[model samples]
Target: MMNNAKHYNLSLDKRLADELKSIGFIRAEQDLSMWCGKERSYFSSMRCRGYGLHIGSLTLMAARIADRMNTTADVRERARLRMALNIVNAVVQEKCRLREQELLTA
Candidate 1:
């Protein structure tokens, strides 16, 4: 079960990274951390702990990304941003579901 959870998190991380790269928003860890309104070590700590970002952070990040997408003039970049937004939204939904399940079990 632990291994499965770790694998799932790693997979999710890869998907998020790939989507961000596609949208050219992941030039550096500092840039991503700044966009998420977090310290530079935040992501590194999350990665080391094998967990994803907090739901609220993800939500804010998605909103910011969507705002950029809305103002983007390049068609290709807009499409890429849209795809990244979808990925972020999906992750946020999944995290919410997991949190709900935890609450119910508690």
Candidate 2:
């Protein structure tokens, strides 16, 4: 490959690919827990409640977001990033909701 100033370095690409792969692996595990094992929790037994979407649902949403976030250079990596971002957003939103519930109950 040509090393051009305009091109992203190979190391950066490798780093991103590895990160995306990790996210995919985790998401796949979540899918197994939720869809196959009848469990609603994942990743060291973290509950999936209040996150607005289960793993299956989030994966579907990710597929939709990936359509918009797609890039020519690395469509797959962008999709993984989109999916991970969506999961993070959901977790933050859910935490806020739980905090509000605690305040109201207190």
Best by lDDT: 1
**Candidate 2 C-alpha lDDT tens digits along 22-81:** 777344444433422345444224322212223344344345445546653576766655
> Which runs of model 2 end up more than 4 angstroms from their true locations?
1-22, 25-72
**CA lDDT, every prediction?**
0.75, 0.43
**Pairs of residues clashing in candidate 1:** none
- Model 1 off-target regions past 4 Å? 1-11, 22-24, 28-30, 49-51
Clashes of each: 0, 0
What TM-score does model 2 achieve against the real structure? 0.35
Candidate 1 on 33-99: residue-level lDDT in tens?
6667799777768888887777788888899989999999999988877887888899888778766
